[model samples]
Target: MSEQRADVIGLGMIGGGVAVSLARRGRVPVVYDIRPDAADHLAGVPAPLASPAEVARASDVVLVAVVDADQARTVLSGEQGLLSGARPGLVVVLLSTVAVPVVRELAETCAKAGVELLDCGVTPGDKAAENGLVAILGGAESTVERATPVLADFAKRVVHCGPLGAGMATKIARNVITYGTWRAVHEASTLAEAAGVDPAKLLTVIDAADPEGATLLSWQRMRLAGKPETRAMVPQVERLLDKDLAAAQDLAGRVGVAVPLVDVARKHGKETLEIRVREDA
Candidate 1:
């Protein structure tokens, strides 16, 4: 329905899902991929075009969802790449999770071609076709505004994180939270199993205590909120954390279980909890 034309390069899981979602929303985008059969597996998505340049020529906003930096580089700047056909005002939304430096390098490349680039980090690749992604964007405010409508066709929520590279940085940081929590869970389950407790029982207790895992982020929320009461409680909380972690370590030793995660958690508990004890205290 919108006047702006949208296109997608790379019809992999994320890109294919995006194209399908857009088509379902009546915004069917022009798409391209190196593999000729890329669109065969994606219903509602039209056949892939001959090249990225062709897609770019037909689009106002182009979403690049290629796998890695090298592929991204090839698609954007290689022979017959998008820049070859891009108009001066075209906007390119990069959806790859590359390093911040790589993002900046790509942005510079786009800028040289008189095209604007926005780094967009997306989540839940499995939910992409259902329009369930959260698009975390980093670019100028005007550039983001120009691409939001097209992005909205595939993403349920769009967050403009900050200037260029911030989206990739935020995505990287978010991944740490996810993978770190997984390691913590692994250690906990291993410890429980070694201590003659069923890991399933430990899971039950954790679920009952925090169904949505709100406690996993409670400390971050408190620190961000900067509540006076939270600040005042930090010292006591840090002390309790040390004691609890030390107990876990002792238990792990007695049960002959390795708890490296717990050990790291204890070593950096204060930093993780954002605790800064006052000199007077």
Candidate 2:
């Protein structure tokens, strides 16, 4: 690697991890966090900086992994933000999970200042600094190429999602799956425990049954192929889902347990799918 450094502006879970990973690879990243203790963990590994502007001044690619959209803006445009010292050719990668519009607006701001900004959403959280997370990138191809070296140091998989906000959009969609699955599993465990089955055992069975993950992937692939094709699979799939949901609802009612999401799924699942497929198509 060149003497030019990669910097991190946030030392939270994701940022801290990435800093450690970069230092482990001998990158010797310059990192800064609002919380003094957050950077304490990186001690000798990263060259700790006092502010985002200093980090931007010291590095070639600056990774912004702050909290939310507001924090992201603060770290990038606030008094001591990265933009204060950012220059042309500085690639600022946003790893925080914010809305698509925020990413686009930031990209424009970066452009106005002659800085290159890429929305690079990361998954697997803190473990990413060690086990390597997946990087979902959105920006011009040349910019993505320029950011590859830094990304490769901490990411196991790098996907160029599309222009500007696409990476954030994709990440938000993934968040939906993450939280929605959590809710579904919670309800499943509740129902299973109520019906005399061990929730852990149910999870084991589920894992065993879908070891390849094709169950969900198949639906995703179908939708990706377009609505006409997805529409064809819906009739049969919806029938099975409707029947199963009806039975599950009956079981829940008999056991005096409420599965409201299940009921909602039963009532609007197909419609939701139809709307999404059509809209995205």
Candidate 3:
């Protein structure tokens, strides 16, 4: 119905979801994927075009959701790739989670073809069809504005992080927080299980004490805010962290459970908490 035509390349979970979401909003995108049957898996999505180039030819904006950097490169530059059919002013929004370097490399390729590239990092792949994804984007402001309407069809919230590779960079950093916290929770669960406590109960206690998990980011928030009062409290917080981590290590030793995360946390207590000791102190 809208004048702006959009297409999708790749029909995997994320891509299929994007197509479905767009269709639900009355913007059934021209779709492409390597597998001939990819469209059958999605409702309201048309069958795949023969190649990425065909999809490009029919689209003003194309969202590429391939699995990795190599596939993305192929989709954009290989024979029958999108660039072969891309018209001037065509915008390609890459939704893959490749490295920052890879994003920049692909952006260069897109630029030479007179196509604009936006590195878009989407989260919670399972929610892609529900129009619940948060699109973390990086590109020139004008390019971002041009693609926002198509992007809005699938993403519930769109954050323009900065230029070029910033979206992928932010995604990588966010993944660190996600997986790092999982590792920390794994260690905690191990300790609790070794000490004859149910891991579920531990989770219950954690949820009850910090329902929103505010404590997880409190230290970083304080450090970032950099108020004099928060800075003054860092040393005390560092001491408390060291003491608690030491106790966890000791408890784990007694229980014969490995607390490697706790060990590392203790080792980097001051650094982790952003506490810098003054020379005079």
Candidate 4:
């Protein structure tokens, strides 16, 4: 989209949203997803359809917006993986939030294959990704710059957090804030319910009175606004969100940092990341 040649895969939400955005910018974008009708919907949009390997061969910049680290690994390492067709000097940008070690491993693997790997995780909801207002945390400075113009297709601000896994670490740090806060609200609201108070009114106080009330205010408002949006109802994968807290805890434990406040929030994330609720709305 940003005057860069690119190819994209995974068209469900992450891939589809980004491809549509890129196609609008007049960039040549080829897209593919496992779903048969995935690319069909966009047939006339000028976003060409290609196999994963074909997409790899057709574009200089490749951005992966898959579901998990395994999906990333498979896209690159499987028999039908992109690596089957990827050439030297190709930069693969990862936008998923995965463990630090996993990304580090990806970097090493990419190097041997003559491919460059950059962890450039984006922060924002589904809509934000489409509008190109997402925050991008990249690993290397040079890789960050090399990928920035291309990344600008779906991100307005592309920043280098530091090195290889630093982008992921930074993303982990930020999620420790949002996911942690959401759990806090869940617990606080639950406590109010058990204490003989209407949970909604208690939640209202949190919404209307607290300073950081807007922290996960959207999550709350959506749930209350009728059948909530699946995403706004729950910001991220439960346990995956918990892992961010765990990562922070591991870091804090090593640095001799006494994070009293974070510990309180950790309990909420630990317990709630596993809860499942029926979407009433």
Candidate 5:
């Protein structure tokens, strides 16, 4: 791993981490962010600074990890975007958890430009990615093969999810479950407290249900444990659930499915959305 092979573009946390990993793997990643200080933060680091367009032009392997599908479009189609800088047979990996429509739209755009657009979202959190143990899903055999070394530089396991956009789809679905489950726990615990059932005891009991419950539940327990230092979420439980519920609802509507429990939790979550995001953000 040296600096010669380091050439990628990133714009998100995952993107930042990937760029750093690629640098460690001998790749000099071209990094940028809309934030004014994005470049200065990484200045002089192995990861070099460049505008989104410049990176896209210089990068043979472009990784888009924007916050949402909208940002993805802006990065690839905006003035001086990826398409302008991309060469033939370029590998454009969409590593964001975005809507299926976003993936398809971006796919069409990349196809028109003759670049191979692969929806390759990854999960496994920051620690896993840092250790190269993240899971990658999407792309075809040849496409996956071509991208394997780059992926391996940041992931321990990579699975091609059949066709294009599969990675994006898988990530969206996974988030819907995870965020929905998080909201469910918050709402349930809130209800329990309102009913005079000490939610503390309930969380303790739930944490023991290993086969059925999950580490997610354990996280909820930690947040709602009544210990002021760790009970940060208690004040804004309603809001956290609200944002995730909205995300889940958005996902459900996209899939043309109805999630009743999710709807109920969201209805309860909205009560806290404004106060929480404002403070947290």
Candidate 6:
């Protein structure tokens, strides 16, 4: 890889911040965006290009940071697409959060065009300029290596998960955990508030109980390996949860507030946990 910065094929929040980060390090990027005035915000940092093809023509590595799979496809295959002017062996790093299948499909498209493709998912969204993102990379080792020099310009941490689509898979799973945890917190807060426990104090108590976050760490560490232990614990856990949930349900009835999630969890907790029990275990 040359010392030149990779071109940026979109100038949205993440891409624009990445361009600024690269430029702050004295690596000016060739930039393009669908909106004609997108480059105006990053005046001194990016050299605006007419199209994705123009950006591809000027730089050996181009980062595509479009919004979705449809826009990603259009940027690569539509008129004025990057492929139109990309040289053979040009590295195309995808920074979109599309489906895993989309990454695989685009990898095939890049292969057919003699281009190297890397599925690179970044997190901490628009903070790339201040606190760089964690880059989740998926591709052949050679392809990942080819994009590393450029990725290092904007990413504080780069993890090569596996070959082709693994980055997006990791990202998707990451989202599930994030949003799912939020949902759980919301339910807990509602239940606590209804039961006359202050929600803020509830959070404080939770923090004190697991100051080092050992519970989540243990859960992650034993995710697949704790089948036998989990099976054994399920019965006891069910009894405890059912007792609490029964009290919670009674409180909710008195308070005239509905607790749909707690109700459902009470009814299905054992059945849900039972799925984790391995047949052999």
* Candidate 2, superposed: residue stretches over 4 Å from native: 2-4, 225-234, 269-281
TM-scores, all models, native as reference = 0.95, 0.87, 0.94, 0.70, 0.68, 0.82
Q: lDDT per residue, candidate 5, 1-281, as tens digits?
A: 32223244554557776766665665656666666455344423343444566776666677777777777888888877878777778888877777777778888898898888778777855743373645456667787777777777767677776787677777777788788877776755655565566888778878776646665556445544435444455456666667767876776565555567777756765342222222232
Write the residue-wise lDDT of candidate 1 on 1-281 in tens digits: 67899989988889999999998999988899888988887877889999999999999999999999999999999999999999999999999899999999999999999999999999988888999999999999999998999999999999999999999999999999889989999999999899898999999999999999899888887777766677889889999999999999999999898888899889999887784434443
Which prediction has more favorable TM-score, 2 or 5? 2
Ordering by TM-score: 1, 3, 2, 6, 4, 5
The sequence of per-residue lDDT tens digits that candidate 3 reaches over residues 64-169 is 9999999999999999999999998899999999989999899899999899999999998999999999999999999999899988999999999999999898
TM-score, cand. 5: 0.68
Q: Which ten residues in a row are the worst by lDDT in model 2?
A: 272-281
Whichever of 3 and 6 has more TM-score, that candidate is 3
Off by over 4 Å in 3: 275-281
lDDT of 4 by residue, 23-97 (tens): 666664776677667756653244445467888888788878788989888888886678778899888888778
Q: Which lDDT value does model 4 have at 115?
A: 90
At residue 24, give the lDDT of candidate 1.
91
lDDT of 6 by residue, 1-281 (tens): 35854889888888888888777767778889988888787745655678888988888788899999999999998899989888889999998999999998998888888998999888989687753799999999998887888888889999999999999899888888778778778877887798788999988998999888677556445446657776677678778879988987888888777778778878987765553655665
Instruction: List all candidate RMSDs to the true structure.
Output: 2.7, 3.3, 3.1, 14.1, 14.0, 3.6
Which residue pairs in candidate 1 have backbone atoms (N, alpha carbon, C) closer than 3 angstroms, thus clashing?
A: none
How does candidate 6 fare on TM-score? 0.82
Candidate 6 Cα RMSD after full superposition onto the native fold (Å): 3.6
Better candidate number, 3 or 5, judged by lDDT = 3
C-alpha lDDT of all candidate models, in order: 0.91, 0.85, 0.92, 0.70, 0.66, 0.83
How large an RMSD does model 3 have? Answer: 3.1
**Deviation (Å) of 216 in candidate 2:** 3.0
